[model samples]
Target: MRAPSGGNGGNAARLWPGIGGLAALVALWWLATGAGQAEGLAARFAPSATLASAAGLLRHPDLWLHLGVSLRRVLLGLAIALLAGVPLGLLVGGVRAVDAAVSPAFQFLRMISPLSWMPVVVMVLGVGDRPVLFLLAFAGLWPILLNTAAGVRQLDPRWILLARSLAATRAELLMRVVLPGVVGSVLTGLRLSIGIVWIVLVPAEMLGVNAGLGYFILDTRDRLAYSELLATVLVIGLLGFALDTLARWLHRWWVPS
Candidate 1:
């Protein structure tokens, strides 16, 4: 226990550098925006009046609605990805012929950037939440699929043999043995997928949703409300970080190290 505490202390110490780096970035941003450091640059490429402009926008009557809308869409996309990705991955990883036949195409499509699919999705779905959800789910699916397949492939052969020896049926072996064994990898994939979804969401929201952080960003820019825009950007980043952290905690608690 003492050794584990010492190890944790070491990790905490290492984490300080990242905190320092973030502080340095904020300082740089402040200086650049202030009159002293980048006055000429600010004149050419202004940081906008966000720090001052932030309050009214933050206090805007509709702020929560916009944020809530985006959050709902993101969660919807995430759920769809988890449901679709895990099963498809299991199919791909469990059978050799299926993996060989389908993996190449999936890989090819996954390599395509999410933004590239935007136009097609919009045209096909004709705008609204459905299109946005599709893009988010598409962006988020690859990680879970690839990771789950890898996990399935890397499973211990002995576990399978033991299951066989115990007179377990094929269905029982898969349900009790295989699923749990690959859960760690599935969580890892979900973490990666969450990150991807968060990143893609902003642009996806620009597709004419009446609400959402993405649309809020556009509104701030159009309204020239820099502070609110800055605040929205900060909120976007924080939300993404929160989602990733939640996934990490889930992985740490629910899955074995």
Candidate 2:
């Protein structure tokens, strides 16, 4: 028989480690959940039970509804961040005066965790999707703004000079030169923002929202559905992984290296 190729061997090498790590994790989880021991509270969280619950949940329409709501919130928050961050970042990067005036305040606001604003946001927005959106947008904003600004700052000065020499209009310069050059950085920011938003989303949804994964989690907890809760957690992790993977794929597609 012909020998296996090096590329296939390399693929196996990369794939096996992840599989092994997951197996080890499952083994650890089994032990920690008191598997094969007398029934206890922890036993309810066994990987077997959680995985089974997750499988069942995946087949449920309500779970899909929750997933849809959560995804919609994430998208809206990202849209808000993009709409606000890009222009502000361009201003901060392209103009020294704007940078000087805005950087300190931006830095200050960025340092504050989005969760810290939850109470005030809920008070003002009054416990609905609006507060959740605000928190998510807040969480996602800084990374995008900072990355975009950095991208702009790192842009080649020669390009700007060349554009100016050609008597390019400001709009033309921004649309043709600056925006294209910063696309990679903007995507990077977007990826980072997605991660931040996903992380914050669960808790943000706890702010009296009637739908979404976060609300489902609370419902599971309130109903004493421990296995379902763990399953929901697993679902959240899987979904977050998928989102990050999609973002990375987009980045690669847009910014080939």
Candidate 3:
């Protein structure tokens, strides 16, 4: 028989540690939930029960609708943030006057939590998806704006001078030079923004939206469905992981090491 390849061995080496950690986590969870004991509330939240509940939830069509609605909100909010943040970031980074003027106010607003605006947003937007979108956009905007500005600041002065010497128009300089240089930073900001948005999404969804993962979680709790609630939590984690992975892949693809 052929010997095992080094690549396969290395892959196994990396994979085993993650598997071991998950196994340890499961063991701890089992113990905490009374280790299969038949008569406790904690038993309802045991790993076995949660996994089973997750499986059942996966088989339900309604669950997909909730997932879709939540995902749509995330995408829309991200789009809004990107549209607003990039131009503002470019303006702030490229112009010293703009930076000096707006930086303090931006810092002040950034310090405030997105959730703090929940009541006012709901009052203004009047419930449903609008408030949730606003909250998510607010949460996601800072990272992208900050990172894009940093990218612009770090850009090579020689590149700008070269473009100007070549008689490039302002639009050409921005599109051909500035944008290409900052793509990596923009992507990094997007990754960070996705995480922030996902974290804010749950509570933001509580503001009168009828269908979403957050609403489903509330429904499950109201019905005393502990296992389903846990399952929903797992689903959220998995989805977040997927989003982060996609972001990482984009970064890797665009930015050279």
Candidate 4:
């Protein structure tokens, strides 16, 4: 008899774990929400109620607006980070003296919590999309900057040597060689940056933005819509997962297997 192909089996093996985990989570959720188990405020956010609330929200147009606003903020912040971080990273990673000078400050700022700057950011920017963008950009910038620099530093010395031998100008070398070589690293940074941006986004939205997931979360709480609040939480998790998956897909597409 011919040996069976492992392709189908391998796929099944990979899929089963994720399915099993989700099943287990649902089972646990039900158990928690069982009569006499989840009481008081928690009871309001029981799985069944939360699912119903989510379904209701899905029927409304406003939910999409909130989601869109949040997504727009994420994109804008990521754009700013990419624009700023790539150049900085290239400078730091390329030149030893620049890296030495900037690394300390980068590390210090990176260690400080993004939310910790909320008071000052709001005070200066004064409660709007701009502040939110600043926070997300700040949160996202480090990963991109560090990764880009690492990518530059890790480039094979031969690549530059070959370019120089060919009389490639600075701009030409960067465009043809350096950029392509570092794309994978930049994508990796972008993946990390997106996750950081998303985490910051929710709280940032809560900072007086009239719309977005974080604002809706607070509104739900104030309205005593615990089920809706839980539903929003679920939506946020799903969106984050989707965003990360997209970033991974882009990385895979841009980089060879």
Q: Report the C-alpha lDDT of model 2 over 114-231, residue by residue, as the tens digit.
A: 9999999988989889999999999999989999999999999999999999999999999999999998999999999999999999999987889999999999999999999999
Model 2, position 4: C-alpha lDDT score: 73
TM-score of each: 0.89, 0.94, 0.94, 0.94
True-structure lDDT of candidate 1: 0.85
User: Which lDDT value does model 3 have at 83?
Assistant: 95
After TM-score superposition, what is the CA distance of residue 186 in candidate 2 from its true location, in Å?
Answer: 0.6
Per residue, candidate 3 scores C-alpha lDDT tens digits across 1-257 of: 99877988897999999999989988998998888884566878999999999999999998899999999999999999999998898989999999999999999999999999999988899989999999999999999999999999999999999999999999999999999999898999999999999999998887788999999999899999999999999999999999999999999999956
lDDT of 4 by residue, 29-109 (tens): 878777437777777878878899999999989899999999999999999999999999999988999999989999999
Q: Which stretches in model 1 have alpha-carbon errors above 4 Å?
A: 1-12, 34-58
lDDT of each: 0.85, 0.93, 0.94, 0.93
Error of 1 at 103 (Å): 1.1
**Winner on lDDT (3 vs 4):** 3
State residue 88's C-alpha deviation in candidate 2, in Å: 0.9
1 or 2, greater by lDDT: 2
* Better candidate number, 1 or 4, judged by TM-score: 4
- Local lDDT at 46 for model 2: 84
